[model samples]
Target: MKKTIIFIMLVAMNFFISCGNSTNSEITTQKENEIVSNNEENSDKENDEGKEEQIIKIEDNEEDEVVISKSQAYLDRYFQLEKELEDSLAGKYSGTTIDMKEAVSIEYDSWDELLNEIYGVLQEQLSEEEMKAVREEQIQWLTIRDSKAGESANEVEGGTMEPLVYESSLAQSTKERCYELINNYMK
Candidate 1:
């Protein structure tokens, strides 16, 4: 009877040990499945948001207009050039006026290209009346930009930093104008 009692206790312990392991494995599997499901849901949400952001809809009495987002390539190039200019000024030139002027000049070229691209888009997308209005605004903006740039340079007249400041001002104004045109007219 003693031996039988010991054997029964061992069998009970073995059953309990096996059940504990099975429960732990099931819990682990459940946690992994939950993580995978959460990841899939987050991915779906991101895709939906991306799609919504890429399209701009404008309601007009004349027609319904859809303005697609500009090509990322052009913007990417502009940003990349700006970054390169910053890096050069900070590291290689150490903020020297001459080197800064050269760097700003390169950035100005990029801004000029962006301006041309915005102009091309306007020409293709705008009605003749709208185009004429934009052209007039652009001419006025150019005058202001040139005058401001000259005044900014004059602030440091005869100084080594004058050209650098002038080019920087021009680049900044052009960039702002590009954004303004895109926001006001493109949409």
Candidate 2:
């Protein structure tokens, strides 16, 4: 189901981001002067009112330190879409829609065709951080796709089954286009 796939993707993303951390170490800085100045100002105000001043501390979670530029975000989105398509095609999905005809429509005759096209677009635009993220995403996507393919091989029904082809092709084509765009942007 869509929920299951979404959950799986979220878990996978979390794993990707949080790998090799003891505590969730994120970037942060202390504004000593600002805090001190605010506290001092508050203390004076409280004293005039014949009351004790209470200091307030503010904390922040600074995850996602590697901020991607707008262009890079587009690239990353493309990369993610491609991954989703690849996963679906490989039947690594647990959704209600298991249209094989649709899934197979994005069949790339060769990886080189995909890689070359993607590389052409991405080699110039993306930053090092974005490139790294895309590469990591690619690996994760491929791993999921391969596992799904293996798991679903037996369950996939065979034969021409022509009438269902239109629906199947539509689904598969959509997935392929999504991945293609992503790969193109990230490459």
Q: lDDT tens digits, residues 1-187, model 2?
A: 9999999999998987786452333221245566788999999887866532221111121222222343355566556656766765665233324455444444432333455455555656678887787678667766665555544443444634442344344344434544655545532
- Against the unseen true structure, what C-alpha lDDT does each candidate score? 0.79, 0.52
Please name the candidate that would achieve the greatest TM-score relative to the true structure. 1
Candidate 1, residues 3-68, lDDT tens digits: the string is 999999999999999999999999999999999999999999998887666543333322432355
Which clashing pairs does model 2 show? Answer: 1-94, 1-95, 78-182, 82-179, 101-168, 102-168, 102-172, 122-187
Q: Give the TM-score of candidate 1.
A: 0.58
Error of 2 at 77 (Å): 18
The lDDT leader among the candidates is 1
Residue 60 miss distance in model 2 (angstroms): 41
Model 2 residue runs over 4 Å out of place are 1-106, 110-112, 156-187
- The clash count of every prediction, one per candidate, is 0, 8
Work out how many backbone clashes candidate 1 has.
0
**Candidate 1 residue 129 C-alpha distance from true site, Å:** 0.6
After TM-score superposition, the amount by which residue 72's alpha carbon in candidate 1 deviates from its true location, in angstroms, is 8.1
Displacement of residue 110 (Cα, Å) in model 2 is 6.2
